[model samples]
Target: MGRVVTLGEIMLRLSTDSGVRIAQADNFCAHYGGGEANVAISLANFGHDVYFASKIPDGLGEGVVKHLNRYGVHTNFLLKGGSRLGTYYVEAGIGERAANVIYDRAGSSFAEMTESEWQKEELFNNVDIFHISGITPALSSSWKKTTISLIEAAKEAGCKISFDINYRGKLWSQKEAGETISEILPLVDYCSAGKLDALYLLGIPEATEQENELVYYYQEIRKKFPAISVLYSTKRTVVSASCNELIGTLWMDDHYYESQNHVINPIVDRVGAGDAFSGGVLHGILAQKSPQEMIDFATAASALKHTIHGDCNQFSEPEVNSFLLAGSGKINR
Candidate 1:
């Protein structure tokens, strides 16, 4: 696979221990993650040449690169400037309770990055694909301009654009998200987002019938952006904080491919699992896998992520394939 470029922020994550509340924890476990950074690490872990482009606080640059380097993501495109790195806190919840996230991203270097500070064409060197998340543009108007310019540069370079509509209601309003995401949809060759995102980002109303949502979402995207070559999403049934049922769906060439649902027990962390799915699907695309293979590989990778602790998907490519071949530990008639 050719080199892929991913642009977005990487934040400092301070997470509370299992079954703990954010306000009660005296100490926290530190990790770094963000939508685009997680995607870059996922592709890199799958043995693809991935370039992670972004800005961090001046002194924090080295630490950020170190984390990406540990995962094989190339950090040559990184720039530094802001006063502090963006940060988020996670409270890992238990059964019947959902995990909680608190964001502290304002005035961060990535959010403060100007269009002139980034040399898009130069950063895009050797890039075959460009990936981004909706979270990037929601940061600030300046970041929005930077994202727009970056997408335009990628399009000019004939690189495929991959977008994850990772809607964060805490960061921006639905109206703003819809407007911003709609602007970039025309340039996207591949898109990944779930039901709520479709509803908010594209103004698609929720289907009263649950089974119809994914297909409808796919149809609406094609209706809105005929240029999109592929659309995919993951369906998850969270039985509890410690367990989830995972499946992946893909739409391409007017056809749909759905993977078998894999049940995960004792989930370690759900943080970066979606990004893992994004990486796996993109990996399958780069490997020229069929639609069925793509969704299967992706869902299996996501299921495996639930068994690992931390923000990164620690499973190797071969490990993911092994799990895929294992048949989701259940047979459907």
Candidate 2:
């Protein structure tokens, strides 16, 4: 297994029960999650040597460390400092009612962390893959610089960089995200972005009506950022708040590969499915799987994630493979 590193915030997630609106909830189920942290957990479940790097409030951070350890993610690089860990709220949806997320993460420990706080030299030691997302840079001006530096340092340490353009409109504007992400793309090896990101963030022009829109955008992206060896995204059709049709796509070796559609009904939770997909793809890459295999595995992992209640994909690699072989809703016995 490869040694992987993921850097970002690990937040406390307080979510309401299904059909309970945030305002009406007197009780909530608390879980711990964040974009990069979620990815770390997934990679760990896949049997990779994964380390998560970030800071959290000293006392309150114990639970966070235990959570990561429970999932097999190493917390050696996790620093304990700052005033508070980040927290967010989720209102679970039912049927056609969509879920909602409220970010109360401003001034959190990870956001306030400085470059000097990290043990940079030791952090990247023998790391094979480094994963991060756009969300870290969106936190603060200081974080933006730190994110870029971390990427550069990882690259110098011979780690393949996997970047997910996990854009959050709540955190930063399109113009700002666009500018920041553009700066980071040239350093990225594997990228996760969709049509909207291509058009809005990367500033790729709209494809002609006759052209395959997503392919055109990806081609344009490759032309502009040649360092990106792999580009991937998902096509999701929302049937309702509880049902979705998802397809994973990959662009590699000058070819576009797609996974079969997965029709997910009665989704238990959808918050971390994308991160799960990203983790699957990274795992596939590390395992040297073919493009088609990678996408298939990734899509299946994502589908399984929708059945779980928390923001982390709890399924292991063998479980994901079993799901692929048996398909959904079949009795194992």
Candidate 3:
């Protein structure tokens, strides 16, 4: 397995029980998660040597470190400082009611992270891939610079960069996201984005009525940012709060590949499915799987995430493969 490094914030997630509303909840369940951290956990579960880097409050960050360790993610580059960890709340959804997130992350430790705090040499040492998301840069102005610096350092260390444009509207505006992400895309080797991102963020014009929309957008993206050799995204059809249909797509080497559509019903939790898919795709790339296999594995990993309750996908690579083979809702015993 390859060594992977992911940099971003890990926040405290307080979620209501199933069918419970945050407004009506008497108590909540707590878990630690964030985009990059969730991806790191998923990679670790697949037996990758993954390290997660971020700043955490000294006394209050123990649980966060323990959470990473439990999933076999290294915390060596996780710096200690700042007054408090970022946090968010999730109101569980059922049937027609959609889930919602409320952020309380302003001025948190990771948002206030400075570039000088990280030792680039140690963080990227022998690392095969460096993964990150747009969320870090959206945190604050300082984080924007730090995110670029880390990407440059990882590139210098000969690590392939995997970037996910996990744009959060609450943190910044579409104009801000488009501007910042445009600057970062050139340095990225593997990217996670959709047709909407291409149109709005990259300023690609809408496809002609005859051209395949996603394929045209992806091809144009490659023309603009040739360094990015692989691009992937998922098409999600929300049937209801408890049911969804998902399909993973990958564009590589002038070819596009798609996975079987997975109909996830009675989803236990849907918080980290995208991160799980990202991790699985990275794992497939590192493991040198075929494009078809990569999309299939990634889609399966995403489907499995909806079956778990937390923000991390706890399934292993073998488990995901087994799930794919057995299909959904079947007894293993």
Candidate 4:
């Protein structure tokens, strides 16, 4: 199995049932999720060896590690006892709407973690791919420094690096974020972006549907990050709260390949669909699937995720392939 290492904060997630606002809800379901960690979990479920590195409070952190281990993810790199787990509240939408999140991550163990807490050599040693996200760098200035160090070490170790520009507006301002992400664009092997994220980083306004926008958008982004090997975008058209159509396209070696759209009529939970798509694409790269097939499988995997709750990491390979082949079926493997 290929060894993948992910570095980021893992937060405790609380979501109210029946679509009640956080202030109105008396209780909520709790789970664990963080972008890089979620991607690592998805990869592990596909049978790839994966590890997640982050700092957490002792008991709560141990619980997170044990949960990750249950999914076959290596948790040895997880550090504990710095502080409490970061948390967020989710209020899922009903009918024709989208979900919302309220992050309560400040002062959490991960946000307070020191650069000394990360043992770069041991974490990246013999690793096939190193994954990171914009979320970590947005946490604090210390995390920004930590992220830079981690990327430098991974680059020196000759590991493939994948970055997701998961811009959280609530975490930081646009100018500061644009400047920071632009600085690191040259250092990554693969970069993922949403339409808004691309426009935000490239300084382009959202395009009108009539403009054949992807072409122009691609040119601007590629010009900005000439060193990036693969630039992927997850395009989604939210038709309704229950229905959305998603597609995957990549700007690779000066060319772009657009894949088919996977439609979901009743999206159960849209949280981690993009991460699942990235996981599928990464898996396809390791399995040597063609670019088109990679997008296909990735799109299919992501579409399937809407039928499941929490994050897409809970899905297995066979389950995704079943949806790919059978159109629809029980999600369990």
Candidate 5:
């Protein structure tokens, strides 16, 4: 199995049920998730030797580690006793409404933690692929410094690095996001962007042709920072809180490849689909799949994630391949 390492924050996600607002909800379901943690869980479920490193707050950190362990994610790099587990309230939205989050992550242990020699050692010794996201730096300036240091160390160690520009407007400003991410993109091997993320994060000018739209930006991206080996973007049409359509594309070796359209109706939860996509492509790469296979499997895995609740895509490879092979999601009786 390939070894994958992810470092960032893990938080207690308290989500309202029945489409109720956080204020109106009398009860909520709890789960452990964050950008890096969610991606780690997805890789673990795919049978990778995955380690997730992050500092947890004092009281609830151990439980979160145990939870990650249950999913086959190694938690040896997880540190405890910072301040408190970060938390967010999720209010699921429906038709004509939008989802919203209220982050309470300031001063959380992981947010306050910085890069250490031990973390650099973990990257050199255990990582074939190292993954992190924009959410890590959004927490605090210390985290931004930590992420940059870790990226440099990972590059020096010859580990493939994946960076997801998961811009959280709730956590930081657009100008800050643009500036910080531009500095780090040179170290990223695989970069993921949403519809306009490239436009805002790296200042790529908008394009006129909506179909070949992203390819236009690709030229701009290469002109500015030519080191990134691959770029990915997933197009989504949100029909409702529980239903959507997704199309993923990849640009590498000077060509663009797009995946088949995936329609997700009545999605169980949409939180971790993108992370699942990241996990799938990383898994494909580690397994030596061709780029076409990688994007196909990654997009399919993401489509399947909409059927599962919580922030982790907890399905095995064969289960995902079943859908990819023949659109088969039937009971395996």
Candidate 6:
């Protein structure tokens, strides 16, 4: 396999215990999470050589780097020595309301990065694939400039680029997100996002259920951004806070492939499931698996994520395959 590089910020996630609010909690589980980093970590866990580029405060950054190294992610291109580490507080929610996230990322190292912070060769030197997300560009103006510079540099390096919409409402407004994403779409090779995210970034009305909105949205999105040759989407139907049917779909060369929805009985953690799916698909592609296998593996990986708490990329391939094989479909994997 070749090198895969993900460009983004890795924040220290402080998550409250189940049913506990951030203000009321005395203890929280600490973990590192970022859309690009999450995908990179998952890919590394699946045996791919992966690297992640992000900025962190010297001390906290060192810890994050060590953690990534433990996960087999190359941190050679990471930048350190900043004042503060970005953080987010997550409170697990049940029933009608979804999980809540509070950001404390302003003035963080990554957000303060200038265009020079993105050294092309350091990250994309030997990289075969480069992955980025909308979340990074939405962080701040400087980050937006860095994201664009990195993408252009990756293209010049002859590497494939994967873009995940990852539109976070809390990060920016819909109008600005749509405009910015529209501008960057032409530079991306492959793209993925949830239906709502695409709709938000593309300013399209929500498509009807019978229309298979993901395919419809992808078609519409590709029309404007012809360079995006491959598309992946995760379809979700929230049954309750603890239950949902999650499916993954892939669109490439004008064909659509769908995966069976794995019903999550009891959701342990909602974060990083999409990144897990992206990881599985990218892993399948690197392994040269058929589209069906890619979607199946990706779906299985995501289903397993919902069973584990705190961004579960520590999973192994045997674990994911076990979930796909056994009738139990539980998280033992």
lDDT of 3 by residue, 1-333 (tens): 999999899999999998888899999999999999999999999999999998899876999999999999999989888989999999998888999999999878888766648778988999999999999999888788888888999999999999999989999999999999999999999999999899888898988884557888889999999999999999999999899999999998899999999999989999999999999999999999999999999999999999988899999998999999998889998
Clashes of each: 0, 0, 0, 0, 1, 0
Cand. 1 Cα-lDDT: 0.86
**TM-score for each of the candidates:** 0.94, 0.98, 0.98, 0.93, 0.95, 0.94
Tens-digit lDDT track of model 1 for 271-305: 99999999988998888899998898888888877
User: Which lDDT tens digits does candidate 2 get at residues 30-138?
Assistant: 9999999999999999999999998989887999999999999999989888899899999988787889999998788888876747767798999999999999999
What ordering of candidates by TM-score runs from best to worst? Answer: 2, 3, 5, 1, 6, 4
lDDT of 4 at 44: 92
Root-mean-square deviation per candidate: 2.9, 0.9, 1.0, 2.2, 1.6, 2.0
- Model 6: clashing residue pairs? none
Superposed model 4: Cα runs more than 4 Å off: 204-211, 329-333
**Who is ahead in lDDT, 3 or 4?**
3
Cα lDDT for residue 218, candidate 6: 76
How does residue 247 of candidate 3 score in lDDT?
97
- What ranges in model 2 sit over 4 Å off? none
Compared with the true structure, all predictions reach lDDT values of: 0.86, 0.93, 0.93, 0.81, 0.84, 0.83
Local error of candidate 2 at residue 292 (angstroms): 0.7
In model 3, which regions exceed 4 Å deviation? none
Instruction: Kindly provide the TM-score of model 1 when superposed on the true structure, using C-alpha atoms.
Output: 0.94
lDDT of 6 by residue, 222-317 (tens): 787889888897888999887889888998777788998778888889899999988888887778888888899998898888888776466777
Worst 10 residues of 1 by lDDT: 324-333
Regions of model 5 farther than 4 Å from truth: 114-119, 209-211, 328-333
Clashing pairs in 5: 242-267
Report model 6's TM-score to 2 decimal places.
0.94
